[model samples]
Target: MENFIYKITPSKLNGTVNVSGAKNSALRLLAASILTDRDVTLENNPNELLDVKIHVEMLEALGKNISIEADRILIKDESFNNELVWNKRSIRNTVLIAGALFARSGYASVPLPGGCQLGDRKIDIHLDIFEKFGAKINFETGETNDTLMLTKETELVGQDIHLPIRSTGATENSILIGSLAKGTTRIFNPHVRPEVLDLLDLVSKMGAKVEVFGQDYIQITGIGGQSTPITPIVHEVVPDNVEAITWLMMAIVNKSKMEIKNFPYAHLVVPMQFLLEGNSGISFDEASQTLSVDGKNATSFEIATGPYPGINSDMHPIFAAYGTFAMSNSVVTELRFFDRFQYLEEMAKLGANIVQDKNTITISGNIKVKSETVRATDLRGGMAVLMLLNEGTDTATITEAFQIERGYNNFVTKFNALGGKLEKVFPESTKEINVTKEALVA
Candidate 1:
């Protein structure tokens, strides 16, 4: 299907939704597994997302045996082909494999990856910093797909590598290489997101010594066990904080009582603190690892998004949608991703008074948005549109819903279970665009 057309009406969700496993965590773990021949079993993995699917296929092509279900994955990489056919469209996660592939077989070849348009997600940092540890790379930009071939001259020696910016992909590549390199490797200015922390923990179980000093520095002591056998351990993937925050918005905007299970509140303390400061009606039960939100005292709030342990740039749109119906103005400053407000125009269709200036967005609250046809441009932005639809007056249609499905698993089913008025209208089931155009002309 090209996209999903969501037919929605004004409704409040009063039930619960179990968030999916973190796509980020699962993919990185998959990459790190290449360093070992031991079987790796990951529980609570999010296999539904499109990105995860692509990575699974890529790993299979590398001669890894993978068995996947809805929430569990068992993978064993005893041997892999040195040559890999490349697809640029979903290159983001595959870039991490360079280090692990080199560690296992001393050779790595894959096409350059080109993924979503979230700015500054380049692989140059991964390539440049990996070279510091003795990985040789040849790059030639091609018209159809840029081919990248990587080989190791010798075993990677432990060294200190500094990143100008804390890019997540670069940090992960360094960790994968450090796990198999000689001596201790220190990474400066690493992006210490929860997913990264989970990856470090997983590798530690696999006999890689890893340490974190504060949020900016990560130290990993290499096993230096090239061609040596490794004992893999069972690891459960971390819960998805982004997905948790999305469902939290659902509970509040629908003005309903909801409970979210398996919520890792520590990883999400920063954004959750913002909601608390803003008087969002939510509370946590640490004993049970659940968050309870009622439809009471949903207040207006302002937040500034930064790196991890701070407000995430992904949370910008979800909160923008929630604050639109608040009692006052909710000002958002997106310091990380500037062009995240593309969905504001579609939001305005719901009678939301949202003003955008450069990287800042100011949303006027207490106004009831209209139920009208709008578009979901990106993953996070598409979710924001869904929250806006709940606060709308009547019916609404959300276009390009595949963007939402990219991250959310069982979106329509979960939303409907929570008393949400949502349905996916397939293009085949609905009127064809070409036929509709012809009818208009006639």
Candidate 2:
């Protein structure tokens, strides 16, 4: 909608909510499914969000037969020979597809990918690894047509590659290609998101030699082809840390308490520890995978967003929302997504005292939100606005909510179920609401 309002009423969130599958892991695993020529079934998968649906469509275009029922995806025609083609407009999942196509057909050519406008997420690391595995990449500088050609030696010959940074996407790409390469591929300075490990686990189950060496290294020995068809396996997607954090921040900002069920404790350790540092009372029971946040009087603290096991970049916007009601200043330094501070402007519209620099957001505590229309800059940013709106501000009109729909399935519905008053107002209807002087006077 051009402009839409969510009329949230202040309410206590006391019940439990189960977390869905990890979107990050599912994207990689879905790409990895193309590695086999047999029927590959992924269990514990979450609902098909926009990115997943787009990836599936891209695969289907490349001649992969796919079927979805419930939380499972059955991918047959594992003999992935055709080039994975996609609309030049849809490049969000291209990197993941690159790994899968490289593993399956020994070559892949697709346009450069797209996603959040978080500055240059250089594919240098990915391309460097692919080149080390002997793939020729040709980038058309002026044009959108980019090509990656894999040769006879296209099969990745496993070798020790050290990463300068611990990028999750690069690490997963390396693992996927390494699984089908000729020798053992050892990656150092790698990211160990449990979701990435889950994909490795799946590849290992498919007769690949994959192992996690402590927290920094992953070793994978090449297995040339799928030994057998992937049997339908039940894989419960890990709970989304960002989602849990969003709800938790909402609870705190609203001066309400909530018990989040299926909360991924391990994945959220860093953020939870940070929240606790901010004086937000939180209790966790690992056995039940539940986290309870009693945020009746939550304070604010500084946070630096980092990679996994650190304050994640994805959780920064939610943290920003929580900062609005904190008793003290909250400094959020986004170390990963340097340019993600654009959301601060939207937060400012809600009367949040926020200032942005190159990579840091200095948030002054104690904001009194005013009803205003704001636009979602990105996925997490959209969720942040939604969380802030839940505290019953006069009325908040948010645009670009479609960005939220990209990652979250029926988000407004879920929030509504929790007593949030939000209605999906289309742009056409909003056009008729011209503020007249008489209406304002009344």
Candidate 3:
């Protein structure tokens, strides 16, 4: 198999761009599909994402019938397969898949979850949740891969699960398992994120009685042992707030004008406040569902990431890129993931001067970075590099370009639609291709 790379040329963004469906929300919906036996239809799904594609394959391996028509996905399962003999790489959503299967048949065997090297994302919390739900958990370690097995000797009994921390996966799994448990399950100290809310919206449409009382707790009344004959549902996914911010930052850094459609104004209250406070040229028209930016006032600012309704840890990299184009210095403190500085080294390849002291990073802006070969260590980190490269007037290669595809959907076409220059290049030999700046911009 030939591995391809992304070759980016200096280009300016203009015109309108539509936001795709949320990757985080869609994956959870796919896993939650198994909670009911009826066919579930999801609209506005970003099926182009590599992670979603891999998860679709995983669902098929478990005996679900999946059909993709344009941006919509229809999932149907006539007969459930509790065990998954997966041969391909698995995603972190497999944990949710286990919970759904346990709710269906009381037993599930799935390959261990695999995802980006984002610090220590342990599954101990998930195991604890399952154990609290009256299920026995075991880990079968193999030479090449490991498998997580869950079994229940009796019906799952609902109980109060108080999360030690605001972990998203643990909270989502609680809802999945609680939907079919014998009684009502209440989750205290849950991470009430937008994606979590989306999942709640989905399962509710499929006949799960879920109620939210602020951020304090969530209660789900299960359908008991009779898990079948669930109401078939059609739902539309929420827009990707992360991608919306990505386009906003990219247009501002490149000094371009862009109008973002399908904009989820409600989900971006905090991040947009920060941008407006920093004097970034931005305006939103709620009636039209459009956000327009001229990118004339891009400047340095300060920010710290936290949980939902705040700047996410994933948004830090791009915000760092946004600060990199300013005439003054910018500071960012990552309070969520302290060890996410692996992308800093790769950013330096493009002349980014970032100093790190523990979880805080000070980015010295006003430096013009030259085009150079860089690697995409993770999904968000890779997109940050692409935005930085777009701010330049030369050609650069991004090795391991597939990392970007895990989140952003149809990025190449969308970039070109906004007058940004990007090309997918497959190497014929070991030598790299060089293009003149004038030729690239022409």
Q: Which window of 10 residues has the lowest lDDT sum in candidate 1?
A: 433-442
- Give the per-residue Cα lDDT of candidate 1 at 70: 74
Pairs clashing within candidate 3: none
308-399, model 2: which lDDT tens digit per residue?
Answer: 78887888888888887888888888888677776778887777888787788788887777667788777788878777666644656777
**TM-scores of all predicted structures:** 0.91, 0.89, 0.94
Clashing pairs in 2: 37-78, 43-235, 44-235
Q: Which stretches of candidate 1 lie over 4 Å from their true place?
A: 1-3, 140-144, 226-232, 278-281, 429-442
Q: Report the Cα RMSD per candidate.
A: 4.9, 6.2, 5.5
- Clashes (N, CA, C under 3 Å) per candidate: 3, 3, 0
Q: What's the TM for model 3? A: 0.94
Which candidate number would show the highest TM-score if scored against the true structure?
3
Q: Please, what's the RMSD in Å of model 3?
A: 5.5
Ranking by lDDT: 3, 1, 2
lDDT (Cα, 0-100) at 266 in candidate 2: 81
Error of 3 at 259 (Å): 0.7
Residue-level lDDT for 87 in candidate 3: 55
